[model samples]
Target: MNTTEKVQTCLDFIDQRLENQAEQTIRIAELIIEDIKNLTAGYHQAMRNGNLKEHSELVRQTQLNWVNQLHDIILEQSNRDLSGQVIQALQKFVSNLNQTQMQHLHFELPSPVAREYDAQYQYLSQEEIELLMGQQRLFPDNNDSMH
Candidate 1:
């Protein structure tokens, strides 16, 4: 597929997966939509400059942005499984672009090992003490562990 088609696929994937109407999700969705628009403009400029012939360069760049953003979100979510899937999707998308368009793309998949260092803490979705009372036993006492 060309870059345009590949970009659309990645955008569709993000829209399907992350376009939740929640406040935070909506903000992210808007950011991604704007990024896509910027990428489209970049591609048009590149084509005009004769740096790219196929529209796939734009698509690849768009997918790259998604993968990069997904890495950040995965870090925030600490969801290893989902992060791996995103990496795989990015790899396949890049490989397809490279093989089909003869355009080499460079990207670094987020390292889970690096991310794990920050995953040592607990992040709560809600501040309700009652909901957490029963789960107290599952965590170490912060006061005792500090030293």
Candidate 2:
């Protein structure tokens, strides 16, 4: 795609993410609200019965459960990184766009060609790695959707 089209694609992806986030926020609020209602009812019932021991135990357990729920929510957090390999394609597109813009602005100089294999700046060779490891023929392509 052309630069403009490529940028639009990335922007569209970002916009969809924002929309999904709004819906996700509402869903989480609904869940927490239900949880809060149940906790409140339990607390009130214990207080009405004048059961100090039961009330205290319920409060402590509620605290622990709430914290565990928070931890689970945090662990399940999502975004572009976990979505797919599109982030890599988007980054590459942006780099190319910047390079093109720099060339048009007459600021970027030609890069020097490497004469020797520089391990420090080496690109990954998937085939070689798998062959050396004597493993499965391929890895799952997370780029399926993007491509």
Candidate 3:
């Protein structure tokens, strides 16, 4: 198979494995493994096509570029609501990455959240909860069909 097809194949296998795992960290590890697999596959494909021989220099450069390109995709975090622990784990992974590895890939660190919640709720300032039914002020008009 070509590089693209091989990468997709490996990704499929990793995705299936992720489906069985319940832990978020395990899934992330699988994703990292999948990236390594794809990069290896790309190298193998280049060798198979005899392209590596005709352009040895080009092949080396391309391999470096390809590895970085693949890393870029794996580093992306889709959910913005991840907890602090999860974010820290990902950051550690990025920090430990080799210099060549991060050339093409970049990690988007999750925004930090408040470590503790305030004991006092803001509702106390209101003094009382009003149960005004059919009150025009609470519920605005102009209802759309979309809900």
Clashing pairs in 1: 3-56, 3-59
The positional error of residue 113 in candidate 1, measured at the CA in angstroms, is: 66
lDDT of 3 by residue, 7-106 (tens): 5565556555444443654565676577567656766777888766655565566567657755643453332223234545654554555455668797
Error in Å for residue 54 of model 3: 14
Which candidate ranks first by TM-score, i.e. highest? 2
lDDT of 2: 0.67
16-129 in candidate 1: lDDT tens per residue? 544342356557768899978877787778778886745576677678878887777667555445645775787687768668765455654355553565665544545666
Candidate 1, number of clashes: 2
True lDDT of residue 49, candidate 3: 87
lDDT of each: 0.67, 0.67, 0.53
RMSD of each predicted structure = 26.7, 23.0, 23.2
Per-prediction TM-score, please?
0.28, 0.38, 0.21
lDDT string for model 2 (30-110, tens) is 777887787778777877888868877877887787688666556545553454356567667777888888787854223
| Residue 144, candidate 2: alpha-carbon lDDT | 56
* Deviation from native of the Cα of residue 98 in model 1, angstroms: 63
Residue 52's C-alpha lDDT in candidate 1? 75
Model 2: CA > 4 A from native = 47-58, 64-147
**Winner of 1 and 3 under lDDT:** 1
Ranking by TM-score: 2, 1, 3
Alpha carbon RMSD to native, model 1: 26.7
